[model samples]
Target chain A: MRPGISKILAACAAWGDKTAFLDCSGASLSFAQLHELSLRLGTAFRHMLKGATGRPIAVVADRSVRCIPVLLGAALSGSFYVPLDGSLPEARRRAMLAAIQPELVVGLAEGTSEAGFRYISVDELYGTLPDADELPPVDGDMPLYGIFTSGSTGFSKLVLKSYAALMSFIKAYIETFGFSERDVLGSQIPFSFDASTKDLYTPLACGASTLIIDKGYFAQPGRLAELLRDQRVTSIVWVPSALSMLSRFGVLGHISLPDLKRVLFVGEQMPVRQLNIWREALPDALFANLYGVSENAGNCLYHVVEKSYGEDERIPLGKPFPGTQVLLLDEAGAIIPPDQPDLQGELCIGGEILALSYYNDPEATASKFVPGPPGVGRIYHTGDLARYDEAGDLVFCSRRDHQIKLHGYRIELGDIECAALACPGVDAACCLFDPGKKKLTLCYAGASGEAALRTHLKGALPAYMAPGSLVRLEKMPLNANGKTDRVALARRYCGGGDVP
Target chain B: MIESNAMKEQIISILQDILPGEDVTESTTLADDGRIDSLAVVELVTEFSIAFDVEIPFSDLVNENFNSAEAMEAMILRLQQGT
Candidate 1:
């Protein structure tokens, strides 16, 4: 059996009264406060929920101390939480709400009400009282939380994670990275994404402090630099885009972060051109590349930048974390020989840290998560391509499918095509991604122009999902299979043809 | 000194190059209108820095400075005078 998340939070509270979290505005919560607040909120949730467990509770995850308790309260109430970004487009937000079908929507403060769903404020949850301080019994196998990731099916996929998976990965992460109460973490990613889980939970698990940097700081790298220096943030686990933005703006050259020790980046490939800029600025800081999918609880592989890489060299994906097994298999499901460094195969992850499943989508769950050969049990078949390097380190090659990562958000080309197809006057649509330019282009055989299609896409998709360019095609190229020839479309649109 | 109207026209030309087919006017709110995202902003910074021979500091990257073509021209003029 595994220990529940409630027990972990209680233990962290008992550890010490160190600061657990602080938002960009300097508002904070101590460990004791976090525990106390969560308990109070959880008591209210227990009263509201009664005996119902594992029910998805949607939380408006704004950068407030109250949201932390709201999330914890869901866990304490024997229910899992799903954090929704307050800034999401209405259509997209409605799509997620429709998918989750949440019974309760937790808001940060009072006067929070949506049309259909019952809305309850986190503050109200804290204010209201239940007779007892006790929480409902919880099992470690129970779902702890669910986070939405990009789905090839156009709709966002809610990946449900269990308490066991989270705790196991947290333990591995903390142990591998040598994090303790002495360290101060600077938050980067928003609470809506899985990357933010590391920032939010690390403090609770390690009894350390977390400084939540403001989202606006990203736009102004100088302000971000100021926060880094002001907070004395020792470690920051961020996405490559965030780090790259700072390097691109040349902010690292202007500022100094003396206390910063560990610089961890994940989500997308770190451009060597930008990584070198960071290395030159913070020579002493240990830069590391982490690789994982939201389908897995967190990161599975990590590589410390021990040596200098050339400006164009692709960094190695590195070895698996403790207890995690990474396998590379060819299209025929046969294991690729490790010694053959040149042989590329799809990356497969097998471990306890794997997510329970995509919430309420067993079809998708079955499609990706399959039983491994004999003893390996269940393994998540990642569509990411990989190859072993000369040093036996796992190196990333290219994506096996049309799935792409732009600005650290995973996107599927199929999803874009689906959105484009849904638009009126659209007959055929193909989305092509230019990796080097980080630009998305659309080639469509349609009556709708760029503006019309863009307007339709704005309603259907998020800002990042919107195509940078749209071109009209008299007819779509088809392969021998009679399917839309995406490669030919990409070559025509992304390579040279500027068919406006 | 180049006339302010000419500078504004040049700025509009640059905006047109960065964001094709968008209505970029003097009163247009670039950020609110969703014309200048992070990627476009980066390109704008590079373009504006080179076009105006002025370094666009990250501090000056706020919405007020880049919300309109007129705003961008004013900023360029101010930076040109080393103010």
Candidate 2:
């Protein structure tokens, strides 16, 4: 057996009957029960895999205690698990499954009969107890999981993570956070997001309990706070948007969480204004701002918020983790001199925890995973513009791509453009956010207004993707790269100029 | 009774203030019509709980119980009766 797998099993055995997972249905699994379930599930998964090498297993379960054992069972069976969020569109889910060509799909839903794959329901997997000796040893170098990133260039790319990389990240997280048996970790991140890997696995690896938060609670902040206090949750990893909503509605002010020890916020830019509220509310807890892309398993840089930062300063991305190296590089891929701290450059990450590659997409893998300086190995080009401040902390500037973060959702402008083009009478369209007004505007070349366009967009896109306003345009400006001049468009639409 | 109709009007006004769009009446469903989201529901429930001095569990804050101004008022009255 692999060392990491052995260690995980040993920890589960040592923890014995202590509670390991709690679902929204009030179902709790002790460590011993979880271990036994995982072993049986692993045996069943191995039988299903039938000795296929590097096969992808798709898991379509909602947030539940069973998700952990299923994911771990897939890993133990030497199969990479691909978590598909049930909330996504069926067409998008089909596109992902078609791209990955998963060998096995496990879900609780009924209508998942796709050709060329074996579908096993959670009920069947849990009911069938196979012999423990049938479980095959998993390889550390084999792929453990694949998380899909909202691809900017048309198609979603699956970032493949190896077992060794996952173990390395887990080790780093435990060392930094000091997780133990007494801690009850709250998980709010979707399984598809890389943030869940930290929230779900790190606790189990350290013999701590994991509290699974229901999706409904996140949408409703009052219930979420109640759950936090009721569960006696000691830690949580969430995006900044959730924190912003909690503060804006005064939920934190109304409810007191006395057991929360650590709060890690990631996925988007952390607003200092909101962070201050959380710090004041949970004065004794540690607040960390983590920065990383899906290409690096989870987080590579973390900034622990101290009590002294006078609320006005923007939080830095802080230094790299123990096994990670962060390099600021120019457009030509050369490292910027350390003395020149003011120069903005793309932040590149190099470490053992770097993801394997973009699954089935060699072209993208080559483009993103480039060779670093001699002997530094492969590094992921994050495409994020940042610079080292005078205090040697990395400060984010903006994204090089056409990605815009509205509220808390990551929306690619191209996706919005594609959706708009599908609308009737829309020849071409460009969507850009007006930060000053907090409104997203769509300028189309053909015809535009709130009536026909809103109806068209409502059918094509999600509720949040619909533009708050629409403007008529003659043509979109193009730059030297032949791409839409987003900067000029932002200035023209947002600067209060007359529409054509 | 300190004007039951006035209390209903006040609750509707508060709901309109919290939720931006959509008309709110005694019969309007809070969950439907997109008038109140999860966060808004929590805020509204907290405001009602504090104003009425009732301990309302989060699980009870559902569409069936507090879907409308009248329903919420009835819930508050029941809690008052219990006390």
Candidate 3:
């Protein structure tokens, strides 16, 4: 590995005045400015940490140009940066901050600041700093960013990713796709999401410019289409839901994005219905399916959609990205042979793209990321089940646990259950996802009504994690194991049977 | 244009069908509020077209137009007028 950071920052000098980032709010940062600003900001962070390195620095991530520098700057501080969604319910952000116990929080709202941690504005971090040569060398193994993923426990697990993992993944991705300095990437994923790493770094790596579309525009697909067309965005890697919304509303029929060259979707399965719509509209663009987990470096597998599939056929996870290795493990922890077609096993990955560890959670880290053979690094057991097809392509079967992906967000059904149980009137809560409807319904034997439970959940969980609907049960059914009979509850309330 | 009670009631009923939670009323905040996600917004746009026979234009699909049942009623009426 190229020691990641020095090469990335040093290569920027040639791009000079090229636009590195452009926000929907009309803010733009050039490559030279981004290079200088991050170093200055890094110097400020060093001062805040009293010269201590490898500390976690929290950035109040909003969808804006300014937040980009903060992300890069935090890494330049010799510490890992954790992007916290500022718009999340204050309680949700609080719990994450408490888990990380960051050295300083950048751009946190004044009134919301906790006393134990120091807070600083993004503007304040732009101070004069040491030259690039003066800074200490950082190895590829050094932690770069920490991403929070849903945990079975109500608290999210912070996955600490190293510089080598991110750089290796980005290098393989942009190179395979042929991203160049002239390309403009349409960025849709939020800063806090691990998938967004590709956007943040791809532009920096290849001297491309990523134009961030406003979050609200997804609700109004026409505006989103307009932004892409007008800005001449050539490439985009987004969650399936955002792309589906455009086709669902017939927004594509009204607009034309002739500039778009390639479109990649990840996080969740993309229904063939919407994919067909996009393929018809942009006949020249490339459509690809990607598979990844928060525990890995954004993504590990990808398959470019070669032939149009029928609505009934599922998209294959395709092949592993360059520099990454994916394997299947049977229940007994034995590696499944690639020749065994149609034999299902839990998908596991090993290579340079694997993350360092789940921060502050040794048990989770140990259980999920088992040690790999001598030089392969640790292997990540993705909790997702898959099998090799006749063509040697990986086919996604189903999730092994209650964790589900909705609208590209990974959600633990147990995480919602844990939060529901925290409510005063809620008792014996079970959350179920009706995959047919793409909705989460929480069944509970509780004193509170739907409105009250919704209010409680709104405060406790992020909007995306909150159950779409609520059901009241006299009491939860119990199985022979003495656990809540989730199957029975799901059938009674969410199936053809009436909720009552 | 004034938001008629019938149109407002239609919008609420349509939203309730898609979201199916607590009762939606004229004052319910739909757009920015966490209650309605992006997928739900697309469904609402489709539902409005079927119910009112008016295609919501790209320019009129902003949050202000869908923030509440009353707001959607007004926007529907505006689109219905060929504006």
Q: lDDT value for candidate 3?
A: 0.79
lDDT of 1: 0.79
**Which residue pairs collide, candidate 1?**
none
Instruction: Name the candidate that leads on TM-score.
Output: 1
TM-score chain B for all models.
0.87, 0.76, 0.81
Tell me the tens digit of each residue's lDDT in model 1 across A1-500: 66787788888987656789888766889898888888887788878877688899999887666678789878888889999887665667777888788978887767857667888876667576633346777899989999887543234688998988877888889999999999999887767777788887888888888887766666667777888898899999987767866787678888888999999998766767678888889999999999998788878999999888864367889989898888999888888867889788899999888899998889989998999966787999888888899888899866666778999997867667767766756656788888878899988864567889889899888899899999976456654222466666766778733211
Could you tell me every candidate's TM-score relative to the true structure?
0.80, 0.73, 0.80
User: What is the Cα-based lDDT of residue A117 in candidate 3?
Assistant: 75
**What is the lDDT ranking, best to worst?**
1, 3, 2
**Against the true two-chain complex, what DockQ does each candidate achieve?**
0.21, 0.11, 0.26
- Evaluate candidate 3 and give its CAPRI docking class based on DockQ: acceptable
Model 2 interface DockQ? 0.11
Candidates' chain A TM-scores? 0.81, 0.80, 0.80
Clashing pairs in 3: none
